[model samples]
Target: MIRLAILGSTGSIGESALEVVRRHPDRFRVTALSANRRIAALAAQVREFSPAVAVIADDGVGGVPDSGGATHWARGRSALVELAGRDDVDVVVNALVGAAGLGPTLLALETGKRLALANKESLVAGGSLVLAAARRGGGELIPVDSEHSAILQCMRGSGARDVARLILTASGGPFRGWSREELWDVQPSQALRHPTWDMGSKITIDSATLANKALEVIEGHFLFGIEYERIEAVVHPQSIVHSFVEFVDGSLLAQVGDPNMELPILYALTYPGRAEDGALRTFDPVASSPLTFEKVDHGAFPLYGLGTGAGARGGLAPAAFNAANEVAVEAFLGEKIRFPEMAEVVARALETAPATEPGGVKEVFEADREARRVAREVSEQLQREGSSRKG
Candidate 1:
């Protein structure tokens, strides 16, 4: 059996991963499970899976653990890193959210374990460091995102030189064709209602803004060692064609599948191999017809450009961009800032970000912290301006 350590066990991706585990008990075993704050959900998963260790990343989860089971409970964030580097687990599913996922991602790869990465922030915030960690310990970093997973499958047998370009598809978000003026009036409720695929609020907002595509582009760069120019994304409303790969010979290949996170999760678990699961195999091209694509409207969704420009700038720029976006997203959700202001917040945060590349993981984190500070300042300033306009 493949021993598994699933971080962020209570999130959207974590729940789907657990569902995959439920289907294939013989193929995979849950060695460790973790959650940020959902203590009740964590407890239920522990009871069901009976994992050897369960972790609650938030210190303020309140109350003590209920003893008497085979599972031993752990608390705080350090426990997450320990579990990732442990000798017991074969695969560390870094399904964590935001930049918090970076440390465990580094540790898992550095410890020579297979890292099934669902956390885009790990690569976006510390691409060079993550690449170095995988190299230093000979760890396998497999992407859990559907887009990256599709690219991975499409380029399975092709050499890096043979692969000419990659085309990542986006759902164009809830505001697919909304004008910039229309976007300014959109509410958080509307943004959270995604066109396809259910996800966490943060990711849903990123998808709505097309910032998620930017994060994916940066991640694909580190995962496949592809340059920014070679990787491009289009607004595919259907989301049937997950990704496209064009070879140097001008031949293009596409991985078409229904939009399901479970397929990618299962693929990450048994990579370079296939598992038999009927539920995940349901896909029909005939029923899903007239799949169309369009160019992104930069005016409406400028966050896409801001994020990719940061990726192109290299060094801590991507990290800063990710951090700023996280802060801006939080503010946007809280209704402190308007939707269109997210791009401005990220842009102003980037202006203050240190120009030097991160020397190590510590530097990467330092950049993140600083960028968040700047982003919050910008967010607050925007909030005040909104008030002034009303006054």
Candidate 2:
């Protein structure tokens, strides 16, 4: 059995991964699981999976119930990295959201474990350091995101030098055709209603603003060793085609599947092999709707440009961009700033934050902190200006 440690076991990606494991009990075993603050959900997962250990982000005040009392319990963020690097785990699925996932990702790589990475922030914030760790520790890193997984599948036998470009598909989100004026007063509830995929609140917001695609562009750069110039994103409303790869010979290959996270999760867990199961939905072109594509309007979604620019600049720029965007998204969700101002906050943070070469995870965290601080300040300033104009 392939022993697995699934971080963020309560999240959407993690839950989907568990579903895959549930289907293939003979091929995979859950050795460890983690959650940020959802004790009830974590408890249920622990009881069902019967993992060797379970970790939670909150303090150990209200300890988890002794579900059979066979599992060891750990509390706090450090446990996530510690459990991920354990010798018993053959694969570590880093599905934890935001910058919080970087530590577990680095630790999994450092311990020479196969990393099924679903968290894009780890790459966006510390791609260099994470890659170096993998090289030093001799661990293989696999992309769990649908786009990256699709790219990997297309480039199976093809050499990287022969590749021309990586084409990533977007769902165009809920605000696909909204003008600047329409987006100014958009609420969190509206932004959360994603048209294609069911994702977490933060990621859904990012998708609405096209910022998720930008983060994926940076992630694709690090994962596939592709340059930013060769990476492109198109609005594909169907969501059937996850991504495409074009070669210098003018040949294009695409991975098409139903818009479900389970396929990618299953593929990551069972790499170099295919699982014959009826759990995942099969793609039927005849039964499905017509596929369509459109050019992304960067004018409507400026955060995409800002994020991709930071990624191309290298060093701490991508980290700053991600940090600032996270803060801005949180502020927007909390109604502290208008929806349109989220991009403005990230832009100001990127403009003000110093770009330095991050030597290690420590430096990346420092840059993230600085960017978040600047983003909050920028949001406050914008809010004050709007209030003054109203007065």
Candidate 3:
């Protein structure tokens, strides 16, 4: 059985992962599960999966029922990392949301466990550090994102030298055709109304801003030995073509599937062997016809270019960008700033923070902190101006 440790067990990806494990019992086993401030949900998971251990990111004071096994509660942010690196875990699935995932990803790679990564923030924040950990620990890293997973499938058997470019498909989000004026008054509810995929709130927001695609581009740079210039994003409302890879000899290969995260989760768990997932529906081209593509409007979403540039640099720059965007997005969701001001805050934070190569986890953490602080300051300044105008 493939022993697995799931980080962020209460989140959307984590739940989907558990469902995959449920479907393929013979191939996968849940050894450990970790969650942040969701003891009740973790308890439910533990009772069902019967994992060897469970770690809670929050203080273990909640009234979580016990599962019929050795369950130990760990407190603090680093608990997830500890759970991920445990000797019992053969594969660590980093499904965490933001910069909080960086440490666990580092530990999983450092401990030489196969990492099925769903958390893009870890790579965007500490790609170099995480890659070095993978190298030192001799562990293989597999991406869980649909786009990266699709690209991974297409690149199989093809030599890295034979690859020409990586093309990522976006769902165009809910605000796909909205002009600048329309986006200025866009509310959080409107942004969260995704057309194709069901995801966590932050990711749905990122989808609307096209920041998710930007993060994926950075992830592609680190996951595959591809350059940022060669990675492109196209708006495909169908969301059928998860991603594509163009060969040097003019062969373009793509992976098409239902817009479900479970397929990628299962692929990561059961690599090389396609398991029978009854949940996945076959793609019907005739019924779901009209697969269209268009160039991304940089004018509508400025964060796209910023993410590409940061990914190209491959240093603390990506970390800063990810951190700033996280803070800005949170502020926007809280109605602290306008939709357009979100990108502006991230751009300002990037301009203020000097990008440098992080020597270790400490440096990466420091850069993330500095970037978040800068983003908040800039966001507050912009919010004050907006309030003044309203007054």
lDDT of each: 0.93, 0.91, 0.88
lDDT of 1 at 325: 98
Per-residue alpha-carbon lDDT of candidate 2 for residues 1-391, written as tens digits (9 for 90 to 100): 9999999999999999898899999999999999988989999998899899999876754866654577988888787779879999999998888999898888889899999999999889998998999999988899999999999999998877889999999999999988888898799999999988998888999999999999999999999998999999999988999999999999999999899998988888788788887967687998767999999988889999999999988999999999999999999998889988999999989986556778777889989999999999999998888889889
Write model 1 residue lDDT over 1-391, tens digit each, in one string: 9999999989999999999999998999999999988889999899899999998888886864865579988888898779999898999999899999999999999999999999999999999989899999999999999999999999989877898999999999999999999999889999999989799999999999999999999999999989999999999999999999999999999989899899999999999998999997778878999899999899999999999999999999999999999999999999999999999999999997775778998899899999999999999999999999989
Candidate 2: C-alpha RMSD to true structure equals 1.4
Candidate that would win on TM-score: 1
Model 3: worst 10 consecutive residues (lDDT sum): 60-69
lDDT of 3 by residue, 1-391 (tens): 8899999989999999998888888888999898888787888888798888888776656764544456665666776678878988899999999988988888888889989999999988988888999999888899999999999899888766888999999998998988878899999998888999999999999999998999999999889988887889999999999999999999999999779999998898777668876669777889778889999989998888887877776678899899999999999999999888888988888885556788888888888898899999988999899899999
| Best model number under lDDT | 1
Model 2: residue 283 alpha-carbon error in angstroms: 1.2
Steric clash pairs (candidate 3): none
Residue 26 accuracy (lDDT) in model 3: 89
Give per-residue lDDT, candidate 1, residue 215: 98
How displaced is residue 152 in candidate 2, in Å?
Answer: 0.4
